[model samples]
Target chain A: MIRTLAGLVIVLILGAVAAAVIPEMQMREELQGVGYSYASRGMDETGSSNLVTAVIVAYRGLDTLGEVVVLFCASTAVVLMLTLYPIGVKASEPSRIVAFTAKVLPAPIMLFGVYFIAHSHLSPGGGFPGGTVIASTFLLVMLGSSSVPDRNGRLPAIESLAGLSFGLLGFWGIMTAGQFLNNAFLGTGTPGSIISGGLIPLISIAIGAKVASEFSGVFKAFRNSGGEA
Target chain B: MTETLMTAIVLTLGGMMVAAGIAVLFVRDLLSAIIITGFVSLSASVMFLLMDAPDVAITEASIGAVLATMIFLWGRGKIGDDG
Candidate 1:
């Protein structure tokens, strides 16, 4: 009876809130009006065909940087936790099919990831998704193989270098353009060209490297901990 | 016409999300629950795509649906079978 009453109260509150907010919700037409204006301005300002990429890497770059830092911190915490309670046996050998697919898949995946990062300024993908795709390739490698050889601490070094480059690039922007992460340092070439969107593609590459290494590092740490691959 | 079609897709995906959420709550098996959670993330990604947010959709599908599930399954292996 009490549970039923509680459910009723929750439903009542949700209904009331929805009723209040529903009328105020903007329709698609209204949203498109605002979005179109932004898209027009964003295209000119960022000199990229992909407005979303411009928004993420050019207009709201500081926010993206903060987001990268957050992911870095989270990966760091995962590493720390694994270090504290290192447990789990090495992963057993995967099945033959898994092994075969793993061998066949990683190269293509890496290539696609690189393409995604490189073409982000002119396409649908960007650093974050591209990085994740690359990391997933690493994950596939770890899954298929019984033991992956240690890289003599290369992953963390890559991560650190990428992060440092990102920061330095931001500072370069500030020095050149009077705004942090500004794109004024490089010329905004033709809109759909590979070299277009000054500072965006560069930043995307840095972020892609940093994020990919960070995630791969996290997976490595977790694998090293007592859990199987 | 497009608006109506979009609304239909949104409702369908939203319903799927709700079903997945409920399944996650009631599923006894931890691994199954984690998979269901991935389904929820997948549905959410679809919703994001319907909303014209491809960047967010990609992020959601990769990190939320794929990576999070992989991590959860890994953790579950460490925790043993009962969980």
Candidate 2:
């Protein structure tokens, strides 16, 4: 009886929300139509054909930096948590198929990740997706290998350096263009070209490296915590 | 006709997402639940693509479907099978 009552209440609430929201949904859709103007203008401003990349890497760059920092913190927390309970036993070797797949797949995956990051201004992909793809290659390695050595300090170092470089780039922009992340500090090459988005491609590279290292470090911490046990 | 077909596809994918969500809730095994959640993410990515948000679709497909599932499975292994 209580379950039925809860279901009925949920349905009623959903219906109410739908009734209240459906009309506004059309209005919201129309509002998004106005976003096309922003897209066109943003392309002109950033000299990137991909409006989303321009918005992310040029217009709202600080937000992206904060997101990467959040990722770094989360990875750091995972590392601290895993270190609290260290497991001495090593991981077991993967099966033949898994091992072979891991060996053959990482190269292509890395190449694709680089391509995705590099072509963010022209494609649907960017640093976040590309970084995740690259990190997955590391995950594949962790799964396939038994005695994966814990690189005591290297991953964190790379993550820190990437983050620092990203910040320094922002400072450089500030000094050069009087704004925190000004894209105009660098040349905004010809539109639809690989190096067109000025600081965007460089920022994407920094974000990709930071995110990739952070995630791989998280995976390493988890693996060392006797995840295979 | 295309609109009707598109609506049908959307409904089908939405149904699959709902089914996967319910399956995740009801599944007794942790690993199976994690895998079902991955399916939910995968369906959501398809929905994002259909909505003309390919960037979001890629992020969802890569991070949500693949990475989250792998991480969950790894965490599950650490927790052991008794749970």
Candidate 3:
């Protein structure tokens, strides 16, 4: 078939292109620009074992704030759009297995999300993922059951509070340490302990709360109208 | 020995991901395409893990593979059979 041949040819070309370009995605031993500084001094500067956390949450914290704001804007836009032009199609009820799984899974999933947010500086995850994982729990419940979630409710307040917390934490850093999102003001603690990462975990928790609430709000908007948002 | 093994694994995963990506394009069923795209993302996550970036790997697996797939499937379901 033409589709098969076309796919093969496309794959061959893309594979070649990938072979050349994909190496860039790999971690280079000699990092460039501020990346080099982050790589060398991140742990020392922030006392965070995970250098990625140090860079994103400590050094380039302002950029991360911007990223969170971007997500906020997107969530806001999605909620507003769906609120105005709601989907008309009704969701098909999930299977019995899905409903049961939904009921049993949210608790453990929530715990896992919390662990990710809390241990992010010591481990591989951080706020964005931890929060999204929490949001998925709400999404699962919506998918499994016929219950209408509270769309216009207390979650927006939580979202607002979380967003404010991020800025407030930044201001606290500025007041105490003369830098935005400065981790050293609170003392970075130890390298690998749960409390070691200082402002990283706190900021991650704030981000997680904001993301979870926003996404849950979006999910609720979709569910409330009896359709996808 | 480990270097060789890692290289082989990377190539295999890369190939699998490309194949999945192509297959998604040609797949007739929307559900199958969505699942194939998730397969692509999962493979990329595994590749990320091999590349010594557990943070990227976790994000790719959780967001790119799981949540994106779920949202796509939900939207597709709502779009109905006519779509």
Candidate 4:
């Protein structure tokens, strides 16, 4: 009874606080102008048509690096979870319907994923979305076949290479522009085109590889756990 | 013009999110509950985009759509049918 009362009191307090705070949290309408200005300047300076990509890769590259690290850490955690306990059972092959869909899905999805990442600097989608799609394609393959190739080793390899490349690129930026992760290596070109942004596309590719590997690792880990248990 | 339309869409998405949350609460099956939770994340991402937080929206959508969904699936298998 005491515990229940305590929980109720806590809930009441939380409710009161939320009621007070939520009014102030109304969506700030001023951001559209600010975001537009930042985007415009970014485009003029970086020669990238995609405002969001420029912000992500050039102005906030460090944050993007941190995001990648977070993904890598998540991948490690999932892999650990899978490896710590042995699940020796193998899953059966998918049904005919699942198999046919899985086989058909990968080609188009992978192609689209690649295109999105490559053109991230010039369009709406970016590395994370593209990478998730790529991972989903791999997941489909796993769903379709019991003999799906385990990609654990390859994942780590790609992750490490991407990490290394990102670091080297950032270092190059610091040397040239006195700012880390600057798109210094990417020469000036017209905006609103795929080839315009220098480091944006490169960064997008790196992020894509990292996200894909990390997500695939998670799916595999979960599958392994289910089979083992 | 597009902005106003976007705001209306965001409001609609927000309503759907509340409904999805309610649905998640009422759903008996754990897997279906998890799937509904994905829709909630998706709805939140749409709202974020409307608010001009595209970067945050992308992150939320990706993590919400991919990582959270996978985690929920694993949790379902572990928890079995228990409430």
- Worst 10-residue stretch by lDDT in candidate 2 chain A? A25-34
Candidate 1: pairs in clash: A87-A226, A88-A226, A88-A227
Q: Which stretches of candidate 4 lie over 4 Å from their true place?
A: A1-8, A25-37, A87-90, A226-229, B1-13, B49-63
Q: Please list the residue runs of candidate 3 whose C-alpha ends up more than 4 Å from where it truly belongs after superposition.
A: A1-29, A94-97, A227-229, B80-83
Itemize residue pairs with steric clashes in candidate 4: A87-A228
lDDT of 1 by residue, A128-169 (tens): 999999999999998988876345869988999998998999
Question: Cα lDDT for residue A11, model 3?
Answer: 84
Alpha-carbon RMSD to native, per candidate:
2.8, 2.8, 3.7, 3.4
Residue-level lDDT tens digits of model 4 in A42-110: 778888877778888888899989978887887898689778874554477678998888889899989
lDDT of 3 by residue, A1-229 (tens): 9998998899899999999998879866687988788888888778889898788888888998898889889888978887788767566777899899999999999999999899889999888788889988888887788775554588889999998999999999889989877788888888888888778889989989998998888778767654543
> Chain B of candidate 1 versus the native chain B: what TM-score?
0.88
Worst 10-residue lDDT window for candidate 3 chain A reads A220-229
Q: What clash pairs does model 2 have? A: none
Cα error, candidate 1, residue B53 (Å): 1.9
Instruction: Go through the candidates in order and give each one's DockQ.
Output: 0.71, 0.77, 0.70, 0.42
In candidate 3, clashing pairs total: 0
Better candidate number, 2 or 4, judged by DockQ: 2
Best by DockQ: 2
Q: What is the two-chain DockQ of model 3?
A: 0.70
lDDT of each: 0.86, 0.85, 0.84, 0.80
Worst 10 residues of 1 chain B by lDDT: B74-83
Fnat values, one per model, are 0.64, 0.77, 0.68, 0.27
RMSD of 1: 2.8
User: Could you arrange the candidates by TM-score from highest to lowest?
Assistant: 2, 1, 3, 4
